[model samples]
Target: MQSQPVLLTAGPRHELPVTWQLSGHARRLVSVAVAGLLIAVITRRPEFVGLAAPALLLLLPGRGRQPDHLGIEIATPAGQVTEGSQAAVGVRISGQGAGQVRLRLHPGNWISLAGESPGEDGWFNFRFVPGRWGARQLGTLEVVIFDRWRLAACRVLTSLPPVICYPEPARLGSLVVLSKLPARLGEHTSRRPGEGVEFAGVREFVPGDRQRRINWPATTRRGTLQLNTFTAERAQTTVILMDISVDVGAAGRSSADLAVRAAAGTAAAYLAARDRVGLISYGKHLRWIAPAAGRRQAERISYLIAAGAGPPYPLEMLGSLAGDILPPGALVIVFSPLLTLRLIESLRALRERGFAAVVVDVLTAQPGTGHGRYRATADLARRIWRMEQEAIRFSLREIGIPVVHWDGQSALDEPLAPFTRRQVVSR
Candidate 1:
């Protein structure tokens, strides 16, 4: 999605009192005045008093007045933003006799300003890219307003709205065509013969066959009438089941993060193919979007994908996903690290229920044994973990579920290429 500003600047808040203080420049002026007076007393120089008089006059009471009204507005976009994309945050200062506006912005994790600070016109036009996904606060904005003579200043703290950053789907130009399509109008060419543009095969000319479908070459070779048959174009349901049970790996490169990005890519590919796509974030709780198709559905799925970047959800026991949540004959594409046995059992349940499925392993690396006291113990435990992971993959394959490993270093298309060659077979 193209990036745009999604938030409006706030209006002036007169009720919020602004407490002004002597600015550093003002404090320096006082020191200058005191030094000049002391030098004049010691040397009896009248010219020193002349220099200190202006400094003392400027420091007199009521020389600098407090701002009558002060307001700070953040004009940055706050809605959905794509990961790795730059966002422009604009802060505007508005009020009568508003002092020189200076902002101290506290940037969030993986979020940094492109430049040093906001420009002279009270606009923070620097671009910042969010390294991670989810609803994240850009940071707190501390606005300091200074008087005309730079003698006094007041601070107004404003919390910037959390931006919902959406993970950009991988560049997947291909779609995984299902072996069987539901009996509904869509983009995929079904195996069943019906009305479509793609040719299925040649068949004996029937009474109801159209003359346009007649194959003259086949008829001439066989000395009998034959006609071309076309398969029906139909849509299928695709459910993206993501396992957020355990997140492994680094902050931005975690298994859960990779899975969310992959799921988004898969959903986009299927939805572009005119297939009904649904999402199920099976972790702390079952958050799902029923099978549907449209631009809105894409937005809904993207929003849900952003939610996966949050802190780990509380552990929830998994028995099995509800049957009603999954459409009959729907394709279940599981994006998981396969960290839990319960998730494996869930996939088993899916296969038993006759759902065609594929597992995209998002585990990028094995847990490492660092140079520590428990290095040997950790290595042994790592070996055990590898065995468990392999056993899980083997067991799933045994149950007719194809498990594909996505190391995240290469394009997802490489691992998913095999699925595109053939349709997923439901057990």
Candidate 2:
């Protein structure tokens, strides 16, 4: 694999006075002064020439040029992490031919090297705590260097590799009661369809039953009886549908971030339960990855989410869906802030296609408007928007689709329980 490019920054440096020789203004001023001085001496006006020459010299044009250089190397963390874990990052900077190079970092999260002079080689070590499970681009590093005289400048750009932060698997005790599901779904059984390790019942021998499942002892116990027991085991396919529309902007936070967290959490949960998981991101553009199982799929999805919001690629929902963006019979869970009409229509269409669709509404409660004419109007507009959102929710339910409203303020399970309960009953 090709190595990442190393970035270099040079601080301001003192160059030889040759920089003055390159100035046209300086040469012109010197020539004019020389001619005036010669005329003054020939005319026998030494005192008058002395005053004029010094003033003329002051008007001479001259400029100074300083040299500066800078270099930066950054080390990023590895993929994957446990809840409450932290990742370490290292940044090194060196200056050449430059006076003290001052640095400014964007995104503010990165800490600077301690006790190091701005112009000298220094090392900065810092840690980032990825609190929630999901994929994330830690942030950007903005480096600025200046010359000793603070005149000339340059810049560099670099993108850190994506990181996958998996959710801590739900503990057994915390898992919703799967009691409604047949006990067979819980145990390991033969790889055959509808048979799991959890005993379901015994029936006359079937052609597909493994000889190991043949209850020979039971056969002898019951004269002339040959039978096999079966259990329940099936793999589910889960599709995470995320909304990247601009309308989700109502909530002070970007809808994209919440959508990523929800998608990541749900995907991780389903994967842990041995289900096939896929992802589809809808905005101005459609991003789709087919259903697959295992760690790599999770990594792929996380990387996409970490890249953050981009201009939506223009495309119709049906066109994308028909093009294999989502598989038939996949349980499609949408994480959106309920911003646009297009998103609502898309969800309705997905349900019409017979997909088990769920919507996790990421709600953001706006702060109360302060006293002002403009504030009053804004508050009224917010009320209208909320009403519209409720109507959308009602419309979705009318079409037999379940909606889960989620706000980052609370635990995810709070909103999830109701929807999951309804799902069991609907099944």
Candidate 3:
């Protein structure tokens, strides 16, 4: 990894001279000074003394001493938290004597901050819930200092620091059943005999056979040497394809969140099986990690899944990435809302090329239905749309693509168990 650049802040050698500016109180004071002078000179009124006295009193307070020694710094621990988890952040005000500090925090769009402003002390602590994944940004913090009279004030916003948020995969037990795994050096048993725990059969002891494997009972019955054989355990390659073409479902949140969470859970489960896992984020931009086995590969895949997708592009481009981007013989599991035609065509293209493709349908029902006037027409249109969707799903299943509809909160074991059993039996 490349080294990160250091940031230069305004402190110590890079410190700036303390400065103060006229507040809104100064503006009001000027109006009062003008009115007092106008009343005395124009009307020769003695009552102007009261107005002039108050203006002088307010202006005199500012002249004596204005607080300028104020600086803001943010103190946060260097660590990580999962999405939807809350993290405590602190903002400390340094070099006081600047009257009462009224702090207002803005923790950006990625985090949901829930806490009051600063108390009597100069410290501000808040619990913020992380909504987006990967390198969460804590927004700008604004502090407005009020003088003793609450009239004059100074407003300053502290700069945001570097904060990285890591993606947290869902907790899945040993119930996640995947498709039939290909033959490789791994945990799953292979058809042919090799070195494994499962008993295969017995054969005449060869020169390379271990003596411990010479089945004594069988050798005694046949009066010959025989060696036990075990099936070789092999792992398969699984690739997660995330389709982020269009985000149109909920009001406050988009469908991308559900898609990402599902992808993360699936990746974690397959990697736990000691299989080679890879990832490909398809949308306006294409990001992919090739298949590999190890702890680092799993972490890399998880990071890419949570690293928010790029802007939307034309969907036609995705159909062209058959053999060029992804390697052959890797099972492709796509998580998508299936809102566009180009996305459908892209999946079809992948299957046409002989890749074992599966689609996790993340698209749920629309929130609200139609109103009074266009009610009948809207209902008819919706019925037709649903019918078309059913046909599309059936077509995919017929072509050997398992279309799994994900319940946002349930375990995926039930849906995947059939797929796993079917593939294993076929193999």
Model 1 residue 277 distance off true place after TM-score fit, in angstroms: 0.4
Model 3 TM-score (2 dp): 0.77
Q: Which candidate order results from sorting by lDDT in descending order?
A: 1, 3, 2
Model 1 worst lDDT run, 10 consecutive residues: 310-319
lDDT of 3 by residue, 1-427 (tens): 2222222222221122345566787878878888997888899887886788788787777654765666665656434556766665666666647577667778788788755444234556656667766565678777777777766777776656645565545444442223444667887666668788989999999897799999999999889998888977778677788876676666323557667777788788878888788877876677777788888987777667766443434546666664535656667888887776777777888777767777888776563668999888888888888888888888888877779877556665655666655542222
lDDT of 1: 0.79
Off by over 4 Å in 3: 1-61, 64-71, 75-77, 95-100, 116-124, 132-137, 147-151, 158-168, 174-184, 201-204, 217-226, 251-254, 308-325, 421-427
Candidate 2 ranges with C-alpha deviation above 4 Å: 1-71, 78-88, 94-122, 126-193, 205-228, 247-254, 308-313, 318-320, 366-383, 419-427
Error of 2 at 330 (Å): 0.6
Model 1, position 352: C-alpha lDDT score: 86
Q: Residue by residue across 278-379, what tens digits does model 1's lDDT show?
A: 988877666778789998999888988886533333333233555555888888889999987778887887788788888999988678885778888999
Q: Which of the two candidates, 2 or 3, achieves a greater TM-score against the reference?
A: 3
Q: In candidate 2, how many Å is residue 27 off?
A: 27
Better of 1 and 2 by lDDT: 1
The TM-scores of all predictions, comma-separated, are 0.88, 0.61, 0.77
